[model samples]
Target: MRRALAVLEQVRDHAAAEGLSLTELADTLGLSKSTVLRLAQPLLDTGLLSRDRRHGHFRLGPGALALGQAYLAGIDLRTAAAEEAHRLMREAGGTVHLCVPDAPHIVYIDKVENETAVRMASRIGSRAPMYCTAVGKAMLAWLPEDVFAQVVDAGLPTVTTRTLTDPGLLRTELARIRNRGYSVDDRENEPEVRCVAAPIFDHNDVVVGALSVSGLTSRVTAARVRELGPAVAAAALRVSRTLGATR
Candidate 1:
């Protein structure tokens, strides 16, 4: 069973347009061609794998797509993210937000507040620009190039004095966010607010959402932002793992 699943995973990982040949699969799985064939037989029978008669390459069959669809149907982002957001709020002593991208903006899906923390103006279902918010930048840093181009083309309006309206600077900041594994708002979204955020990924290693710790500038200072960055990133990683992100 383990070997069969490994074979399936290898095929999934190498799922190019032409798929993989028997020799390639044998080398990748470190098994004899006959052994690899034996392992793949059951998968082929179950419709999870298919071999091209002409090219002799193996590819994922319709069964794989069905399994993927079922898995996506069962996942609820807000439910999967709740515990980590609450834990971050408790430990970080700030408001926590779970946001998902909506092209030029990000929509807040869940918010958890520490009782003693200052209340933020943001609420569930509210939208914020992608250029100035930490949660938005966290996701933008990991999303595709076409998505980034779309955000830039939409215009980076200045939300506050600290907001990065220049495309070049914003691009630099996104690169930094990718390198550091997190992003900081630095009072860019709102004059009195600061936030630290990290991206959340789904099973296919796609960026699906973000988690952030938001607080007043007085409480979440420069030093505090630095302190919270890695912690926020670790908390977000836990959420990503729950969603089955391998990385």
Candidate 2:
């Protein structure tokens, strides 16, 4: 494991610095050029690694993009959860989102909004603060301890009157999310917007992202949140399992 990751990391880091040819890279890694060539072949096929203009020098390739798409398609946790999100939307008439924490912020990778044709402020590729939304909270609950510490070190920026800016309180909130298996955004990220999010775990039982449903604060009242929470959580759990998460 160490050797494989090490080689991938080294190739990525060194490619830009040394601009090595196959022979030079093999010499640098203390491997035969043929071995290096063979090792690089798979990534080359996947476009994660590529050869230089001469096909002798190596560089990261477009195949990496293919792998990214493949990873998303193969492990398509968000896509799987999207169905549940859409179902929730259909059942309750709102917008749903699938997001992953990118630290400092979260990015929506998929969504299913109502059919009303009204323009929404969020969708796939949109970014939101981790300290504000339900998806952010869901994603944050599973963040590595050291990363959480870093988030705590950086003062949380308040986006609205409902935003949780205190690190201590936010930490407490995260704890509750872990226990409850879901999160809520009560007009925190944006005034008048309420969101509910559930964590989606991967095969390793690690949170890879969150599934959320959002609507006008008036629409997702406290009572309505309670009503829809279980459905949303179940959907997220189902998607997690489809992604190979067992727990």
Model 1 spans with C-alpha error above 4 angstroms:
1-72
Report the number of the highest-lDDT candidate: 1
User: Candidate 1: TM-score?
Assistant: 0.74
Model 2: residues with Cα > 4 Å off, grouped in runs: 1-73, 117-119
Measured against the true structure, the TM-scores of the candidates, in listed sequence, are 0.74, 0.68
**Which lDDT tens digits does candidate 1 get at residues 95-169?**
999999998999999999988877999989999999899999999999999998999999988888999999899
Return the number of clashes found in candidate 1: 0
lDDT of 2 by residue, 129-222 (tens): 8878898888889878876876667668888988899888999999998898899998988888888889888867888898888888777899
Top candidate on TM-score is 1
Poorest stretch of ten by lDDT in candidate 1: 67-76
